[model samples]
Target: MVSVAYDGDEKTIVRRRFLISGIVQGVGFRPFVFRLACELGLSGWVRNIPAGVEMEVQGTAGALDAFQHAQAHDLPPLAVVTSSVVEDIPSIPERGFTILPSADGEKNIQVAPDSALCGDCLRELFDPADRRYRYPFITCTNCGPRYSIITAIPYDRPRTTMAGFPLCPDCQREYDDPLDRRFHAQPIACPACGPRLRLLDGAAEPVAERDDALTRAVELLRAGQILAVKGIGGYHLAVDACNPEAVRRLRERKKRDEKPFAVMAADLATARRLVVLENMEERLLTGPESPIVIARKAQNCPVSPLVAPANGWLGLMLPYAPIHHLLMRDHFQALVMTSGNVSDEPVAFEDNDALKRLSAIADYFLVHDRPIHIRSDDSVMRVFQGKPLFYRRARGYAPRAVRLPFKMPPLLAVGAELKGAVCLVQGEQAFLSQHIGDLQNSSTCDSFRHTIRHLSGILEITPQIVACDLHPDYLSSVHAAESGLPLTKVQHHHAHLAACMAENGLDGAVIGIIFDGTGLGTDGTIWGGEFLVGGYDGFRRAGNFLPVPLAGGDTAVREPWRMALAWLYRSLGKDAFDLDHPVARHLSDTEKGIFAAMLERGINAPLTSSCGRLFDAAAAVLDVRQAVSYDGQAAIELEALAEGAGVSGTYSFGIADGEPLVIDFTSLFTDLLADHAAGADTAAMAYRFHATVARAAVEACVRIAGQSGLDRVVLSGGVFQNRLLTEMVYTGLLDQGLQIFTHRLVPPNDGGIALGQAAIAGWQRGC
Candidate 1:
C-alpha cells in the first residue's frame, strides 16, 4: 500500500531508467532510492541487478530533475558511485514505488568495506531504554561489518555469516519496515536474538557468561592479565597498556621482542594524551575506516614506555567496534591490542584455533559466538605531508576494488615472497587480498592459498594466465609454475616500476628509481638499488649501485655490523678495519677473521647493491642499532634517530658513463668516516647521509631523463616507506621540473607487486 500526491494542474509524466554502480549493494542504496522516489511523489520501481541498482521512475520533469540531483548528492554514507547512466523511456501507468527482486546479470558492483560504529547506533547502544542497549553487536543500516562477513554477491543475510542468526519478532518487524534504519541491514541484531559472549579459562571451561563475561574480562585486564578477545575479523590479545609488567609479559610470551605494538585508546582525548594528533589524523581516527595511525609519542606519556620501547612514534587506533569501545570506556584508558598469533602465523579467526594457538600466551579468553568467514588484520597508516600513507591495508579498507586503466582479461598474480598478498584481475577491476604475513612460515603460506581460493570463489574468476616473480626459488613463483596454466615471469624491479605506472594510468616509458632490500636481478645477483627506464611492456636497467659482497648472506640483514664491515672493507683496504669505529671495536677477533676469510674465498657471500643494506650499515657505523628484531628495524630506527636534525651538507658519488651506469659511493663512505672521527653528532650525520642518498637519487634520475628523453619519474620499492627520504627525493625532483609519480592506492612495498604483475600480463596479452 502507498500514497501519491497530484497537483491541481495536470502535468505530463516522463520516465527515466537509471543504472548505478560501485558500492551500491549491501549499503542501503535501494532503500535510499525508494525513499527519495516516494518523497518526490514518483511512480515505478527499483531493483538490484548484478551490474548495480536499477531504477525506473515516472514523474514530472521538475520532480525528476530533483530526484536525479538527490541521487548523486544525497547518497547513503557508505555508497560510492563510480558511474551512473540515465536513459529516457516512455511513461508507464504506475501508482506507487516498489522494490523488485534482484535480477541476474553481469557482476560489476563494488563491495563496501567494514565500517566503524556510527553515532546513531552508538546512541541506541548506550541508551537504557533501547532494546539493543549494551549489546555487543549493535548495528544499523548506516554502519556495521560488511566485507569480512560477506561470502557472495547481491549481499543478503543468507549469503553472510549472519545467516545462522534468525531475527526475533521485534527485529523482523523493524527489518520489514521500509522507514526503519534496519530495513535491509543484513547484520542487524539485538540483545534478544544475537551473538553472546563467554569468558573461558585456559582449560576452556566457562567462568562467566553474557554480561558477566565482559565485567570479568575487564577485571582480569586491570589485574595485568592478557586476554584474547574475539573481534569482527579475528582475535586480539589485549592488556592494559599502562601496566608495564603486563606489556612485558605479553611480549615475552608472544615471542615478539622489539616490534612496536598497536594500542587502542578509549577516544580522541585519550589518544591525544599519548600521541600528537592533527586535524587530519583525528578525522582518520574517527572515520569509518578507523585505522592505526603512527603518531609521535608525547613527552612523559601516561602509557608505559615498554609499549613502544625505543620507538619515538606509537601506533594508535581508536576503538572501532562497540565491544572495544565499551571495554575501553568502562575499564581502561588504553589497551595494548596486538594480533593473537604467536609470531609468524596468521591471525587466529576461529574459536578452536584461537584456543589452541593462543593457549600458551593468553591467560583467558573473551569468546563470542559470531563466526568470522574471512580473517582480516587491522589496517596501519601514517600521515606524511598531510597525506595518509598505508603501512598495511586490511579490515576497513580492502576488498574494495581499484579500477584499472583499461579492461583486463581473467588473470591471477601471485605476489612476492615477502609481505605476501595475491591479486585477481577481471574486466576493469583489480581485487587485492588483505596483507598475508611473510610466506616463510608454513601457516602463512597456507593462508595465502586460502585467500586465493576464497577470493576466486567469491569473484567467480577463472584465470587464463598466471603471473609470478622471476625468482625461481620464491614460493609464489613455484606455486605459479605448478598451477597448470599459461604463466608469465616478471622481473622484480620491473614489476615495482610497472605497479606505479599502472596505478597512475601511465602508458609510456618513465624513469624508475626502485630501491629496496633484496630482489633477484635478471643477471643472477641480488638487486635493491636500481634505476631503470620502462613501462608496463618492458624496462632497461639504467643505473645501479656498486656491487659489494654480503659477507654472510642473510646474516648481514640481522646483524648490521656485518654489512658495515663489508662496506668498509670494499671502500678501503684491510687497514680500514683498524679505524676507531664502534662497530669495528665491538666485533670479536674470531668473528672478524671468519668474515674476512669468507669474503676473500667468496664462500656463502653474494654480491648485492641494496640501498636497504647501506642504511643498515650506516646505522651500525653510527652505533644506532647493531641487531634487529624485525624486518626494516635498523632502517626504521635510523629514520627515527634523524627525525628533525637539519643538515645542509651532503656526500658525493661518482656516476661512470656506460650502458648501465655504475653509481660509486666511495667518496661518501670516506667523508662519513672522517666526519665520525671529527666528533659530529650522530643525528646530524644520519640526516646528512639521508640527504646524500636523496641527492644521489635525483642526480641519477636527472641524468637518465636527459639521456632517455623521459621526463616522468616513478619512485617504487620499500625504501620509499621512509617519509623523510621520499619527501626529500620528491621535492628535489620537482625542483628539477620533472613529473614524479609515487604509490597511493597500492603499497610501495612487495605487497603491491602482484597488481603490477597482473597489469603487465594483461598488457602483454594485448588486452
Candidate 2:
C-alpha cells in the first residue's frame, strides 16, 4: 500500500531513505528527527544502526521537503551531521513518526566531545519544583558527558559506564517518551537512581553525603581549603582564586612553580572582572567546548597575584561541570581549577589512585560514585586574530574526527615528547587523543599506551602502520619501534611543515619556516629554526638560522646565561668576555676560560640552529631573565617586555648564500650589545629585537621565494606560539603579497605533530 498525505488538497506520496553520520549518535539525533517528522505531519521512522543514524520517511512530497530542510538546518546543539546519503525509495504504509531500537551493524560512528552543562539542565537542576533539583549528576539531551563515559562503540547505555545504574520509573518514562527532551538520553537519571555524591576527608573516608557534602565543600572553600573535586574527565584541585594564601598553598603543595594555573569563574560576568575579553574570547569561554581561554588581565584584578605571577594574561573559564556550578553558585567568585597531579606526572582519574597521589596536595575530596572511563584534562586555548588557538586539546575537543582531504589507509601516529598526543586514522577521518602529558616517565608513558588502546578500541581501528619521530631516544619513538605494525620515522621539522599544510588543506609545497627548541636534523645535529619548501610527499631545505654552540647541552636550556655566553662567543670570539655586558660580568676569569674552552673544543656542547636558544640568549643579554622555570618562559617574558614599548625599529641582519641559505644575526647581536652599552631602555631594545626577528623572517622568505618560485608561506613550530612574533611575521608576510597559513585546528607546538606524521605516512604508503 502506498502512503499518501494531503497538503491543502495536493495529495502526494513519496519515500526517501537517509543515512546520516558524524557525531550523530548519543546527541539526541533520533529524538530531533522524531520531533521534526511530527512537526511536518509526516510518517517515518529513525533508528541507530552502527553505520550511523538511518531513517526512511513516507509522506507528501511538499511535507517531505519541509522535513529535509528542517533536518539539515535546525539541529540539536550538540549534534553534528557530517555527511548524508539520500536515496529514492518506494512508498511505505506508516501511521506516525517513531524511534526504533538500535540495530547492530559495522561500527562507524563519531562520538561527540564532552559538552558543558546545558541551560535547560541548569534550570531543572536549580528549580525547587523539579524532581532533580540540585542534582550534581543532572543532564539532558543537550549537554553532559559523552566521550569520557563511553566504553565501546555505537554509544549506547549498555556500552557505557552508566550501564550499572538502571533507570527509575519516572526517568524511564522520560527516556521512552518521544516528545520528552531527554528521550533516548543515555545518561539521564534522577537523584534516586543517579550517581551518588559525597565528601571524603584526607584519608579517603566519607564524612558527608549528598546535599550535606555539597554544603561542606562550599564551607571548606570559603575557609581557604583546597578540595580535590572529581570532574567529567578527571580530578581537579580547586581553591578560591581570590585567596592568596590558598593559591600559594596549592602551588607549594602541588610542586608547581611559575606556569600559570587556570581558574574557573562562577559565570561570564565574574570572568569580565578577572580579565579583558573580546567577542571571540567570550564566545569560546561560553561555547559547548568550555575551554580555558587565555586573555589579557584587567587592571588590578582581584585574583591573587600567585595565580599567574608576572603574567599579564590569565587563563579563565566558566563552570562546565554541574558540581562546579553548584559549588560556586553563591559561595565564591572564582576558584583555582588546576589539574590533579604534581608538576610532572599525568592527571590522576581513578578513585583510589587519585586518593593516594593527590591526598597530600588536597585538604579534602569531593567525589561521586560514577566511573570515568577515560581521563581528559580541561582543554586550553587562546584567541589569535579572532580565531581559536589551542594550547591543549582535550575534554571537549579530543576524539572528534577531523576529515582528511583524501582517503588513506588506517594508521596510528605516536606523537613527540613534551606535550604528548596521538592520532588514529581510518580512511578519511582522523581521531586525535587528549593531551597525554610529556612522555618522560613511566606514568605518562603508561598513559600514552592507555590512550592509544582506548581510542583504538572505541573506534574499532586496526592500524596498518605506526608513525613516530626520527629521534630514537623519545619514549614514543621507542614504543613505535616495538609495535608489531610497520613503522615510519618522520623528521621533526618536516612533520611541522606538513602539519601546517594538512591543517590548511594545501596540496602543493610552500615555504615553511619552522622554529622551535630542538629537533634531530638529517645530518645528526640539533635542528630547530629551519626553512623548507615542499608538500606531504617530500621537502628540500631552503634556509636555516646560523649554527651556534649549545654550551653544556641541557643546562643551557634552563640557564639562559650559558646560551648568552655561547651567542657572544660566536659573535665576538673569546674577546666577548672582556666586554662590559651583564652576561660577561657573571663569569670570573677562570670560569670564562673554562667556558671559552668548552665552546672552542665543543666539549659536552652540541651545535644547534635553534631559534628557541636565541630567545633565551636575547633575554639573558637584555637582563630580562637569568633562569627559567619552564621551557618557553624566557620567550614569554621577552614578548611581555616588548609589548606596548611604543618603539618601532628593527635590527638589520644579513642572509649568507649557500645550498640552504643561512640567516646570520651577527650584526643584529652586535648592534644589540652596542645599545645595551649605552644603557638604553630595556623595553625598547626588546621591541627592536622582536621586530628584528620578524623583519629577518620576512626577508628570508622573500629570498627563498625568489629562488624557489613559491609565494605561499607557512609559519610553524613552538616559537610561533609567541603572540608578538606570530603577529609580526604573519603581518609582514601578508604585506609581501604572499599567501600565509598557520595552525588553527591543532596546536603549532609538538602537540599537533602526530597528525602531520599520520598524513606523511599515508602518502609514503601510497594511500
Candidate 3:
C-alpha cells in the first residue's frame, strides 16, 4: 500500500496547537510526548514553555485521535496534566516527531523537586571510561536535584543552583542531543563541574581530600566513631549499629532514647539478613525513591540490635546518592542513619550549623559543598498488604504531590501535635511537607514556618484558608493564626477518620475507630479510643470508651501504676485502693497516701478515655512494666511480650448503658490477683489481657455496625501500630465478612495527620 500521508499535497487541512498546565514541567512530560507521538507515527514537536508545556501535532485523523486518547490516561507516573486545551492553528510541513528546546512561554511554570539518582546514572558512575565515573553527584534527566536546585519558575540551568557551575563542552554536547536522557536535563553536570566533598575532624579542620571523604567516613564508622554526613536533604548522624556502645553513646549525645533509629546497609542481601522482606517490601527497598522504613523485622535480628533495640522492626534504606553508595562499597557492613538533631527539633543541614550543633553527637563530619535550599528528612514507610504506607514523606518522595481522588481548592493544613507534617492542596495535587517533628519547641516551630514559606513560594499558592487541629496548645494552631489566613479547626479524631477515607478513596459515611495515645476531646477532656460516624465534612461521636480518672496529669503516663490506681478506683471504688501489689511496694508510704487522697478528691486529675492509658494500666496489673523508660515503652513491651501466646478468644468487659463495653480493670485486676494466687504466668495474663481487649473492641464495633446500618470499618490512630492488636482486629473483622479499610498510603499514627487535615479542608471547601 502507498504510504498514507494526510499532510501531503493531496490533502492538508488544519493542525491544533495545545498548552498543558499544572505539574507539566520537570517530570519527563516532554519526553513522554515525544515517545507517544513517535509511536503513533504522528508528526509533532513538543517542548517546555514557561507556564507549562506546549505541543503541535500533525497527522492522519486516526493518529491524532490515538494521541489524544493516550494523553488522557497514559501520562507518566508523576505527571499531572491539569488542563489540556487545543487551539486551531495553521498547518505546517509534516515530518517526524521532535522534542525542541524549552522556550519562554507567558504562563507561570513550576518545576519538580530533585529525585533520587536513576539506574543509568549509577551504571555510569561505576564505568571507568565514563567522564562522570566515581563522581559523587552524578545525576541524569530522570533523577537528581530538581526541587532543591531550582531558584524560580521555568526550570533551566540559568535559574538553578547549577547556574554557578557551567557545563563542560562534552556535557553541553549531551544537552544538545535530543535522543539522549541528559538532553534538557537541568541538573546535569560532569566531574569537572559538580559539587565537591571534604572530610573534617571534630575540630572542623580538613582531614581528607574531596574524593576520600567517603572512604574516611567509612573508616571512622568501622572504628565505632560517629560521623555527621551531609545528605541530599539534611545531615545524618551515622555510626555502626552493630557496635552497641557506639549506638548508646550517639543516643546519649543526641538525647534520643528508645525511639528506634533507621539503618542503611550495602545492598538487599545485607538488608535481608537484618529484616524479613516480602515482595512489596523488596520493591520499596530497591525502588527509585528507596525510603528508609518498611517491612517489620524480628526483634532479635543479628546484624544490629541497637538499630531497633526492644522494637521488632528497624527502618532501612538503600544508598540512593553517589556518596552513600561509595560508603557502603567497603569497610562498614551497615550503619545507623538517624536524623542529626537534638531532642524536639529538625535535623541540622548546613556545614557550619552541623559543626556547631552536632559537635557533641558526631565525632567527625563528612561535608559537601552543594547548598541545600530546602531541608528534607528521609521518608519512612511500612508495607501493609502488598503496598507501602508512608510514615514520614520527604527526600526522594516529596514535592511530587499526590493527586486527589477529588479536586480541591487551594488550601494549607497545619497538622496536629507529634509527628507533625504540613500539606498544601491546589486542584488535584497535594504537596505534603517533610517530617516537621513535633510542634512543641521553638526550633521545630521555626523550621515548620521556614519550610512552609519555601514550599509556598515554589508552588506560588496563596491559601484561601488554613486548616488546623482543634487543640489550642498545638504550635501548629498558633502558626495558622500568624499566617493571617482564615482558619478551620478540624476535630482531631475526625481528621483521623477523614485521613482513612482519603487514603482508601472512600466518601461515604462509616464507623471509624480512632484509637491513639491522645487527642483533645470535644468534651473538654482528653479522648482516645473513640468511634466516630461520618465522612470528611463532619463526624458524630458514635461511641467511646468510658472515662476514667487520670491521676497526676501527665505523670500517670510515665508511671503506669498511677493509671492502675485510677483504674482500681473506677472498678472497685475507694475501698479497693490496695497498697499490697508489686507497684505499691515501690512507692513511699507518704507518696501512697498522697496519691490515694488525690484520686479520692479528684485534685487536678482529669478524665480520659484513652486506650493507651488502659494499656498502661494492664501493664501495671500484670507487673510487665510499672514505669516507662520512654513514651509508649510499657505498651510496646507488653505487645512484644504477647508474642507466641495461644489465643482462647472468649473474653468480655462490662457493658455500660449499651455503650462500648467499659473494660473493667478492677475485674482484670482481680483476675490477675487470682492468677498470681494460682501461680499462673504473668506472660499468659498479659497475652490474655491483649486478646481480651481485641475481642471487646470487635464486639463493640459489631454491635455498633448492626445498630447503625453500616458495615465497613476504618481502623486508625497510633495505637494500631501494635502489630498484635492490628492483626487480631484485621483477622476478626475479615472473618466476620465485613469490608475494612486501614491506613496504607499514610500511617495510622499522627504522621498521617496532615493528609487527614487536607482531606477535611477539601471537603469543607467543596473542592
Best by lDDT: 2
For all predicted structures, in order, the TM-scores are 0.97, 0.97, 0.90
Error of 2 at 396 (Å): 0.2
Residue 611 local lDDT, model 1:
90
Residue 457's C-alpha lDDT in candidate 2?
A: 90
> lDDT for every model?
0.87, 0.89, 0.78
Q: Write the per-residue lDDT of candidate 3 for residues 455-482, one digit (tens) a residue.
A: 7777777788899998987899888877
Question: Can you tell me which runs of candidate 2 are displaced by over 4 Å?
Answer: 1-11, 104-106
For TM-score, candidate 1 versus 3, the one ahead is: 1
Clashing pairs in 2: none
lDDT per residue, candidate 1, 647-733, as tens digits? 677877788888788888877777788889999888898898898899989888899989999999999999998988999999999
Which residue pairs does candidate 1 place in steric collision? none
Q: Could you tell me the lDDT of residue 290 within candidate 3? A: 73
Off by over 4 Å in 1: 1-12
lDDT string for model 2 (1-767, tens) is 12334456446688889988888887888998998888888888999988789999878788877887877788898988778888778987779988888888876767888999999998988999999999999998889998899898767789888998899999999988878988878888889898989999999888899999999999999999999999999999999999999999999999888888999999999999989999999999999899999999998799998998878899999999899999998888899999999888999899999999998899999999889989999998998878999888998998887777777898999989989999999878888899999999999999999899989998888899999999999999999999988999999999998888887887878899998998899888899889999888988888898988899998999999998888888889987989899898888999999999999999988988999998999999998887898779888988888996999998868898887999988778888899999988998999999999888888899989989999999878989889998899999999989999988888888988998899899988998
Better of 2 and 3 by lDDT: 2
